[model samples]
Target chain A: MPNTDSILRFEKVTVAFGGDPAIEDVSFEIRAGESRVILGAAGSGKTVILKTSVGLLRPDSGRVFLFGQDITEMKEQDQFDLRARVGMLFQESALFDSLNIEENVAYPLLNQKAVNCPEDQVHARVEEALTFVELGHTLEKFPSELSGGMRRRVGIARANVTEPAMVIYDSPTAGLDPITANNIMALIVKERDVRHATTVMVTQRFQDGAIMARYKYDRATETLVAATPGDASIAGLKFLVMKQGRLVFEGTLAEMEQSKDPYISKFVLRN
Target chain B: MLDFLKSPVLAVQEFVFLTARTIRNLPVRPHYWRDILMQMDIIGVGSLPIVLLVGFFSGIVMALQMSRALQTYGAVSQTGPIVAITLVREMGPVLTSVVAAGRNAAGIASELGSMKVTEQIDAMRALGTDPIQKLVKPRLIATCVMLPCLTAIADFVGLLGGYFIGISLLNLTSAEYWTGAYRALEYDDVAQGLLKPFIYAIVISMVGCFYGLNTRGGTQGVGLATTQAVVSSIVWIFALNAIITKIFVSF
Candidate 1:
C-alpha cells in the first residue's frame, strides 16, 4: 500500500555487503508519531534496514527522504545537524567504556549546538532520561559495570535525551529474558504513546506484534490497517510479508490466517 | 593460510573503499579538537621519556662495548666517531620507531577498534560523522609531527650518552670524545635518521587505524587487531629503517 503521510520514506532502498544482498530494494514509510515495527525471523535483514535509516550504511541505489529532503545525499555536516531529530538504540547499546552513565546519556545533547543547559542541568536531564528507563540509581556507574538490560536502558536514555522526533530501535529485546524483554518493549510503546517521536523498531520477538497497535494508513486503499497480535493476525491488519527479498503475502492479517498456504501456516506455527 | 591472506587483502580493500567513502563524507563542522590534541599527547608525549631513556642507555652500552673491543688495536679513539655515527644514523630512529609502534600505534588501534566493536564507529557514521576525519586524521597528523621530533631528541641524547660513557668507562677524556664525536657526525647522518621516523609514524598510524577500522567478530577481534597493529607496526618500523639506511648510506 502507498503512503502519503510518511515523515520517513525509503524509495527502492537497497544495501549490499561484498556484492551479496543483505537488504534489497525494500521500501517503506514511517509516518510522524507512528510506532512501526519491522518483524522478521533471524537472518531476515531487519537490523540492516534500521542501520541504513540512521545513515550507518549507504544504499547502493535509491534515495531515503526525511521530511521531503534527500538525506542519503546530504553532506556530513548537514546530516550531523539533521541527526538531532533522529536517534538510534544500537543492538549492543554502544556506550563508551570510559564514560559513566551520566556522561553517556548526555553525549548527544552535549554535541548539540542548541542545548544551552549547564552542567547541573545536563546532569538533571541525564537523570531524567535515566529515570524514564528506571535507571536513576545507576547514574555514577561506568558502562562496563552495567548489566545487559541496564546497558540497553542506558542506550535508550542516551538516544532519546535530545528529545528527538524519530527514534530507531534495533533488536531491543535480543539476548534478554522474557520478562525483561517485555518490560523494554512496554517502555518503547509507552514512549510512542506519550512522546511525539516516530518510533521505528526492528525486532524478531513474536510478542511485539501483539503488544501495541501499530497502524498504517494505506493511501491507495484509503484504509487504516494494523499489525496483528499473538504473533498472528489479530483481527484485520494490512501486512506485506517478504521472504528472500520478495513480497509474498500482501493482504489483511485475517486473510493470511485464513489462507491454506503451507508457508503462511508454517510461519504462524514457527512464530 | 590461504584464507588468512585472502581475508586480510579483502579487508584492506574494504578499508581503502571505506576510507574513500569517509573522505567524501567529511564533515564541515569542527568536532571537539581539544580531545584530539590530548589523544596525541597521550600517544606521542607520554611515550617520550621511555624512548629517550632507552635511546641514551643503548648508545652508552654500544660505545662501551666498541671501546673495549677497539682498545687492543689502539683504535679506542675511533669509539666516539663510531658511536656518534651509529646513534645518529641507525639506533635513534629505529628505537624511537619501536617505541612509537608500541605506544602510539597500539593506542590508536585499540581506541578505534574498541569503538568499532562496540558500534560507536557505526553510530558515528549513523549520525553522519566521518570516523576517518573525526578519529583517524587527527591521530595521523599528530604522529607525523611528533615522531620526527622524538627521533631528533633521541639522536641528541644518544650522542650525549655515548660521550658520558666514553669519559667514564673508556678512560677517554671528555675533550677527546667530544672532538671525535663532532668530527664523525655529518648533517647527512642526522638527516637520514631524521627522515626515517616520518615514514615510520605514517606507517604506524595508518596501519593501526586501518586494522582497527576493519575490526569484526567482536571484542576478541578488536583485541587481536590491536595486538597485530603494534606487532606489524614494529616490524615495518625496523624493516623500513633498514631499507632507508641501505638506500641513503650505500655510498
Candidate 2:
C-alpha cells in the first residue's frame, strides 16, 4: 500500500554493486513539501540512496515508491518519463562539458519528453533559470570556463528549470570554501521555500544540514534568515544520519543533538 | 577459480546486453540527428587524412613487394592487378578499419570514459535522456554509415598508389596499369571489401562505447579503458575479418 502524500518512499531497499551491499535495508519516506538532509561520512551510501530514490540504481531487494507508485521494477524507459517530474544535481555538478551553459541548462527542457516545454519558450526559460542562480550572463560559457561554485550554481539552475515536484542534491556543498558553500546552500533554500518543492540534500558536512534546518530563504531581503519558532518550513526539515550502509538516525536537529551514539554525535559535534 | 572467472564472464554478458540495446534504439525516436552528424564528422571526416596516408603507403609497399615477385616470373607488369585485387579484397577494409580502431575507438573511449567518471552519464539519465539512445546509437549509426565510405576512399587511393608505382617504377603504360587494375576487381571483391568495414564499424564503435560506459576508478580507469578499446577493437576486427573472409571464400 502506497501513501499518496509521500513523494519518495524506500521500503527495506537494498542495493549492492558487487559483493557487499552499498545500502542495506534502507527505509525512509519524504512527504510533499518536506526537506531531508542526509548526512554521512565518505562511502556511507549517501549518494547510493539518492540514486536509488530516483530509479538510477535499482534495488537488489525490497521496493521503492516515487509519487506513490512502485518504481522498484520500473523499466528504464518508463523511469525516464517518471523522472521528468524530479530533478537531481549529481555530485561534481555533472554539467556536460561538451555543451555550453545554455545548451546544458536547456537539456532537460528539450530532451525530457515528459517536460515537453514548448520550443519557443526554451531560451527564455533557460535565461530565467540562469538568472535565478545569478548567472544570467554565462549562457555561452562552457562548464570549464566557470569556477567550481559557478558550475554548482549552474547545476542548481538546471535542476530547477523544469520546476520539478522534487529535487535531489548529492553533496551540493562538499568541497567548497565556507562562503561559497553557504551561497550554494542559500540557493537550495531559496529553491525549496519559493517552489515549495520537496528537497533531499546529501552532505558530508554537518553544517550543511544545520543550515538547511535553521535557515529559511527570505525573498524580501534576498538572504537566508533564521526561522522563527513554529515556522512550518522548519518543522518539515529533518536530518537523516547514515552509517556504513544503514540509516542510523532520522529526526529533527534537536533529536540528533540529544543522540548519545558516538557515531551520531561525531556528525553533530564536528564541523 | 570461480571468483577469478566471474568478472570476465560478467563483462561478456554486459557487452551482449549493451549491443542488443544499442541495436534496439536504432529505430527509436529522439534520434539526435545533430549528434549522429557530428559523429560522422569526427569518425569519418576526421579519419580521412590518416586513412589516405595509410592506404597510400600500404599500396606503395605492396606494389614494391609484389613487383619483385612478379619480376622473378618475368611478369612485373602485372603489379597493378595484384595490388588492386589485394587492396579491394582485404587490405583496404582491414587496414582502414584497423586505423579507425586505433583513432576513433580510443577517442570515443576517452571521451565517454571522462563523462562516466564525472557522472555526466548518470546526469544524462536523470535528466530523462537515455544515454544509449543519446550517446551510443549516434556513434554506431555514424560509424556504420561512414566506415564503409572511408574504406571506399582508401581502396581508391590505394589503387592510385599502385598506379603511381606501376607507371613510374614498373615502366608500364597508363592503359596497361588502369586496365589491369580496373578489370581485376570482381563483384565479390567489392562486396567483401564493403561488408568487412561495415562489420568492423559495429565492433569498433560498440567496443569503444562499452569500455567507456563501464569505466571505473578515476583518470587511471579512463586510460585503461582507452587502451582496452583500441586493443579489443583491433583484435575483434582481425578476428571478424578472418571469419567473414572464410565464409566468403567458402561461398
Candidate 3:
C-alpha cells in the first residue's frame, strides 16, 4: 500500500484573478508514492491548480501543504527551497532556448543549488538524464534546432534531473503524434515506478490517465506491463475529473466508467 | 476625467513597485554574475560603433551650424568653445541615451516578452529561479555601468569631430580650437555629462524590463511591448533630462 502520509494537500483553495475565480474551493490530496491524474477540458483551470501547488500563484483563501509543511505562508526564499523538490513540465515543453540540450537538462540542478558537483559531474549527470529521455546524442544541440518531440523530451530530462519528490506534468502529451505521445507517457510512467515518486499529471485526454494507472514498469523486460487482476499498484493511480474549475468526479477508471453522472459518462466515452 | 488620470497614476505605481523589487533582489543571494557579464558585452561593446557614428556626425553638424551663427556676429573663432560646451553638457549624453533607448531597450523587451509568451519565465519560476534576479538585475546593472562609459566615449569622439570640422571648414587654427575647447570645460560640466547618462540608463533598463515582464497575448504582444519600451524609455529620458538639468542649474 502507498504511504498514507500526504505529499500534497489543497484545502478549500480559492484562486482568483481580477475578482474572477479561476479555481474555486478546490480540495484534494495525494498520498506519498501515489499518482493523481487531474482530468479537465480546455480552460478548466488545471494549470492554475498546478501553479498554485508550487506557490507560483497564491490562492485568495485556503491553504496548500507540501511535504506536510504549509507553503501558503512561507517566505519567497523558503518557497524557493520547497519548489526545488517539486518538478514541473509545462504544456509548451518550455525548454530554455538560450541553452543547449545538456545545459537545459542541468538548469534546474544548477539554478536551484539542488546539487553540488564539479564540472565533470554536472556533465555526467546531464548526459545521464538525456540518455534516460533517449536524447543523449543531441546534448550539444539548441532547443530551436530540435523537433517538437525532442524538445518535449529535453523538458522531461530537465524536470527529472532534480529527482523531485513530487512531479507535476501539465499536458505532457498535448500536441504530439500518437506514437510520440505514447513514448512520452511511457517515459513518465517509468520515472514514477523507478523512483516511486508521487505525481500529479493534468491532461485533457482520459486515455492518458488510464494508461498511467493501469501499467507497471517491468525491469526484466524493460517495458510497461499491464496490471493483472487485483493488482495493488492499480490503486496507486487515482483520477479527478474537473469541469469549469471544479472537481466533478473522483475515483478509479472502473468506477468512473460506471458512474451514473451524465458528465462523467459523456467524458469517459468521448471521441 | 477621473478615469483618464487613474491609468497614468497606476502605471507610475507599478513602475515604482518594480523598481523596489529589483533593488531588493540586487543584494539577495544566487547572483547571476555570468549573465551580468554577457549583458555588459551586449550593451557596452556591441553598441560602441553606433555610439561613435552618432556622436561624430552630431559634432560635425553642431560645429557647422554654430560657426555659421558666430560668423554673422563676427565671432567665428568662438565656434570651438560653443561646440565643445554643447556636446559635453547636453548632446553627448542625450544622443547616446536616445540610441540606447532604441537599441538595447527594444532588444531587452522583445527577448523577455518572447520568453514570457513561450512560458520560459514561468518555467524558471517553477525551477526555483527568480526571474528578477536572473533576468532583470543583470541587465539593470549592465546598463547602469555601461551607459556612463559609453557617454564618455561619445563625448571624446564628438570633441574630436568638432575639432576636425572647426579646423577644416571654419578655418580656425588647430591650437586655437584645442585651447578654446579645453578652457570651456569645468568640473560641473563634466559631472553633469556623466550624471545624465547614468540616470538615463536607469530609465531605459527599468522601462524595458517593466514592459517585458508584463506582456500578454502572443507575438503581437511582444511587438507592442518592444514599441512601448522604446517609446516610454525615450519619453522618460527627455523628461528626466529636463528635471536633472534644472537641478544642476540650481546647484
Instruction: Give each model's whole-structure lDDT.
Output: 0.75, 0.94, 0.89
DockQ-derived CAPRI band for the predicted complex in model 2: high
Clashes within 3 Å, all models in order: 0, 0, 0
Q: Model 2: residues >4 Å from true position, as ranges?
A: none
Q: Which should have the higher lDDT, number 2 or number 3?
A: 2
TM-score of chain A of each: 0.82, 0.98, 0.95
Q: Runs in model 3 with CA error above 4 Å?
A: A1-4, A117-119, A229-232, B1-7
Error of 1 at B124 (Å): 2.2
- What order do candidates take by TM-score, descending? 2, 3, 1
When 1 and 3 are scored with DockQ, the better candidate is 3
How is the predicted docking of candidate 3 categorized under the CAPRI scheme? high
- Summarize candidate 3's per-residue lDDT along B113-168 as a digit string, tens digits: 99999999999998888898999999999999999999989988988888889888
Model 1 chain B: worst 10 consecutive residues (lDDT sum): B21-30
TM-score of 2: 0.99
Best by lDDT: 2
| Model 1 error, position A252 (Å) | 7.3
Tens-place lDDT digits, model 2, residues B98-197 = 9999999999999999999999999999999899999999999999999999999999999889888888899999999988888888999999999999
The reply for model 1, stretches above 4 Å from the true place, is A1-5, A72-77, A112-121, A214-242, A245-271, B1-31, B49-53, B186-188, B242-251
